[model samples]
Target chain A: MELWYTEKQTEYFGITAKIKETLVAEKTEFQDLAIIDTVEFGRMLVLDGMVMTTVKDEFVYHEMVAHPALYTHPNPKKVLVVGGGDGGVIREIMKHPEVEKAVLVDIDGKVIEYSKKFLPEIACELDNPRVEVIVNDGYMHIHDHKNEYDVIMVDSTEPVGPAVELFTKGFYQGIYDALKDDGIFVAQTDNPWFKADLIRNVNRDVREIFPVVRVYWANIPTYPSGLWTFTIGSKKYDPLAVDESTIPEINTKYYSPRIHKAAFALPKFVEELCK
Target chain B: MELWYTEKQTEYFGITAKIKETLVAEKTEFQDLAIIDTVEFGRMLVLDGMVMTTVKDEFVYHEMVAHPALYTHPNPKKVLVVGGGDGGVIREIMKHPEVEKAVLVDIDGKVIEYSKKFLPEIACELDNPRVEVIVNDGYMHIHDHKNEYDVIMVDSTEPVGPAVELFTKGFYQGIYDALKDDGIFVAQTDNPWFKADLIRNVNRDVREIFPVVRVYWANIPTYPSGLWTFTIGSKKYDPLAVDESTIPEINTKYYSPRIHKAAFALPKFVEELCK
Candidate 1:
């Protein structure tokens, strides 16, 4: 007998993985979640039939989502992660000694509970002394807060279901108000292959609210398209102006000083989306 | 009812696309060749059940392979492409006005015959007056010529079956000898995800033979991994030293003057492969 899991990226295309056995499967309050062992990717996490992250390549996504925005800010002491229930982003964010406090907010507590049991390597940092885990809607959290965080990271899922509000212009405006004067924020802007219009719209929306806006990219194979993009909006600091001297030596597998600047150099087709 | 085509990248992982219909399926003397109508990727050419190229994303691969080498050299007049049966590389090569002639040598003539009929968008330039189409062994052709070409592009299949010899160090040495003193050559090095050793070995082998050797990247969705790497070996001109003003205004969906330099700036894990 054989078992396989597949996610249809589009109506006509999808990716599949042979599963060794199911670790956990649940109907969470917000979405369906599962963790299964795989032959190639070790253990894998899936939400709403979409592959969220894999043990083999989670470092790529976590490092990319956290490091670019963290390094871009000169003094990012207070940090907040919206809708990152797995705590992967917080783990990467806590690496910087400059970060005095880190807060994570997700609407679903089941994702956090299951991840701690199944994906310990990624979820261990959620219980750190400097970190705060809040089981509440990230949208309302951003709406209520004002000039609270120095660096804000949106490690949310795609624009679907409850997360649709995160991709809108008003959410970006709320995030703009939630950051300090010199604050910087980054959001996973999705792929430009099938979601070209989504990327273009998000980039344009952020550009209107922030003085400095940049679109960078990272490659995470489990995503809808392996070519993943991220958009950074800053009040004063430019991500491209991040000096080499200020880049601290952190333990990472994918993000580096040279790659920090290189990620912004989009291909011609992807460059067209930013325009 | 629905029909789908799947390629197992490894024992546990694969990518699939819905098949509209099979255009052509045959067992040629060299390998299995098939053309299928895909719902999302348009027409796709598959060899041995592995996708070689697709009409939708072929521009990314063909443009990435030809433009970097073409733009690096101050003057690229004589060019040779070995094992590019589909003539996609030749089409891109002929775009350069400096090029006086281009030669395409592939072992399988059936591929050219089928490509001309089924993939006209990619293979139309094979009949151009400036192109010399030869049905012969690429390895032998390289060995027969010594310092005869200004630029050589090895658009060959992966290191499997008859294409195994193309990835050997001896074949790279043959390419070095076949080029003029200031010659430049580029070859598809595959993806670092499943072929890290191949990329590392190719980089090491080419670095020993050429003074200016660099590894670059492109994003092609249907390939084994979305992230693909290409290596260039030059005698006099370095790909990194390409100036902005010298880059011609070419019609490409992926390549650009900024991308020409950015492609060489790989991710940290990919950069570790080159080391």
Candidate 2:
């Protein structure tokens, strides 16, 4: 018998991968979560029938989400990652030596717990002393803080269920209040192929609150379209203005000094979606 | 009473789309051909169970394959599209007023005939006076020509049955010999997700023959991984040195002056694949 897992990428389309075995599949408090050891992508994390991360390609998404904004800021001492229960983003954040404190607030503790078990390589850094893991609401944390963090990263799921509130204009305003005057923030804005309006609206809202706003891209094959976009909103620092000499030697499989600038250059259709 | 079309993107992964109707399915002289009208990706052309192009995202592939080479050359008067039977490359190549003539040489006459019937939008320009369509093998065509064309594009399918020679080192050298002293050539190098070694080897082989060789990316969701790359080999012109001012205004839905430069910027991991 063949064991396969399929995600409905759209109402009429799906991507399927042959799996070796199912390690875990359960209904978490907030969403359905599954961890599977697959043949193509290795250990896979799925939430609500959607691919959250895969072991092979997690480095691309994690590094891209952390590095550009982290490097753009003159200093990122205090970092906050909202909804990164998988700990991939936290792992990347801990790599920055200047980051004195890294806080991760996730609504679902099961995501954090299971990731640490199934995806140890990605979740290993969550145990670091420099990192703080909280089982709480990310929006409330942002709303409660004022000028607290140097860089705020939203590593949330698609704008649905608990994550729906995270994409609103009010949440962005809260993020503005949560960051220092020169703070920078970046969020995965989903694929331009399926979520064009999401990216456009987020870019518009972030641009309204931040002095410098840019949209970039990376290729994560397990994502909806393999073309993923990230919108970076900065209070003062511009990601494009990063000094090449200042880019640190981080342990990365994807992100680099040259890639930092290139990520902002979107395809013509994607650039038009920004409008 | 449901119908679905599945393309096995890899040995363990397949992307499936719900078919509203099957436009055409036949065993052609060269390969098995199917034109599917799906609810997700609209009209999709599949050859031997591999997606060649779709009505929805073909622009990304066709535009990326054509514009980068055209913009790099100071003047592209004569262009040769080897194996672009669908005529999408010819359509894009004709957008340049500087291109006096564009020739499309494809071995499969059935592909051209079926494309003209089913993929009218892509095959529309195949009948243009400035365009010449030849039903012949691309490998032999390149071997017969010497120092003739200004630009040559290999818009062939994957390195499989009929197209196996298109990816060989001898074929690349044949392309170098077929071009004028300062001509440019590019071929679709597949995606790095499943074909990392293919991209690395192609870049290495092309670099040995061409003075300037670069690999760039574009996202077409219907493709294997959505992250499709193209390897460009140039004799004298560097795609990076293209002056922004001289880029003529073209009517394009996906290609533009800004994207002409941006497409060359690959993610670090993708860049490493070329090395």
Candidate 3:
């Protein structure tokens, strides 16, 4: 019997990948997740039946979602990462020398545990002293903490299920409340190609609270919409006005100081959202 | 009847798009190309059964390929575009105020004529007096010319078929010879995720001839690999050391002085190629 896996890009298109067997399958309290070894796309990671990351091209999503905000801030001291239970964001954030403390908040604990066990390189820094792993609702955490974090990076799955509320204006305002005046907020918005309306809506929502809001593009191969968008919201500095001279001297697989600034350069349609 | 359109990603994985009917189908001398209204990706341009650009998201590829090199040079007096028959590069190059002359060299004149007739908005600026249209081989043009251009942009098709030579060391050396001492050379390299080997090869080849070589990424939806890379080669100045104060004053859709400097930043995988 062939194991069937469906990849829903949006409502319009879906690719069904037939797998040999379920290498790892679990029904976590939050969602159904699995990591399957396949002939195509190499090793695949799916959460709640939604494709999250694949070994073939996980670098694009992982690097883009983590690097831009981490490298953009002047001095990222205390950082907060919400919904990235996979620990990829934590790995990238740890590359910065100034990041004294990092808090990983996700409603689902199983995702972190599974990722830590399987994807060792991505979750290498999870055991580091600087990290404080918290298994709880990220929304509540944001509301509870005020003016505490220098940077808030949201590495969500998608705008569906438990992650839907993260895209709302209320959650964005809560994020604004959680960050210091000079702090920066970066969230993985959906793909503009498949979800233009969502990208536009999220940009508008983020712009309402933050003085500087910009949408950047990253190409994640495993995603339904190949072209993905990340929206940056900041209170102090523009996302485009980053200092190139002060890049962190760390060995990173992705996320260089040069890329930090380039990531904010929007395409024509994405740039139109700012207008 | 279901009209089947297979977008050949590689020899292995080809995405089959179920279409209703052909909106516009024409066979040029080089390849069979068509513009079809599809159920999933909207109005899609299919060249040799591969999706080149779609109406939903062509800006990512067009803007990224055009903006970085155009904006980086302090003063772009003369610009030469290689293989951009679609006229998208011309549209972006015209945004620079200092660009007194813009030359386009495309082997397929039919592609230029068809794009001008079909996609007028993208090909609108082709008739500008400063824009010189040349129907010849881009490689030959570069080999013959020397120290004439401030910026040389290669917006070729994939590194296969007619474009295979464009990825060679000889071609890059020709581009280097064509550029002025302080001139910049930017070309669309392969996607980092799907075409890592190809990108590395191109990086290696370009680095041999040019003093400075760097690879930058862009999110293009229609391409085979969603994670696209652009390699830049310069003779004198590093792209990262661009002067922000000297940025050109132009109403651009994407490229800015801020982004010009940022495009030089590389991910670890790409930066490894430079070493």
- Every candidate's chain B TM-score: 0.98, 0.98, 0.89
lDDT of 2 by residue, A95-146 (tens): 8888999999999999999999989999999999999999999999998889
- Give the higher-lDDT candidate: 2 or 3: 2
- For each candidate in the order shown, give its overall lDDT on alpha carbons: 0.90, 0.90, 0.77
Candidate 3: tens digits of C-alpha lDDT, residues A1-275:
65656664654455555566677798888788898765567667788778887666676677777667776777789999998888877877776778999999999988888888776766788889999999999999999999999899998888778898899999999999999988889998887666778888888888899988878766566676566778889888776776776666556565566566666666555666556
Among all windows of ten consecutive residues in candidate 2 chain A, which has the lowest summed lDDT? A242-251
Residue-level lDDT tens digits of model 1 in B5-90: 99897778999999999999999999999999999898999988788899988999999999999999888999999988898999
Candidate maximizing lDDT:
1
lDDT of 1 by residue, A16-68 (tens): 99999999898887888899998878789888888888888899899999999
State the TM-score for model 1.
Answer: 0.98
Local accuracy of candidate 2 as per-residue lDDT tens digits, B1-275: 79999889999998999999888899988988889998888898889899898888888889989998999998899999999888899989888889999989999998999999999999999999999899999999999999999999999999998999999999999999999999999999999989989998999999899999988888788887788999999999999999977887687777777777777877777878887
Which of the predicted structures, 1 or 3, would earn the higher DockQ when compared with the native? 1
Which candidate would rank higher by TM-score, 1 or 3? Answer: 1
DockQ per candidate, 2 decimals:
0.77, 0.73, 0.34
- What global local distance difference test value does model 3 have? 0.77
Q: Between the candidate structures 1 and 2, which one is better when assessed by DockQ?
A: 1
Prediction RMSDs, each to the true structure: 1.2, 1.2, 4.4
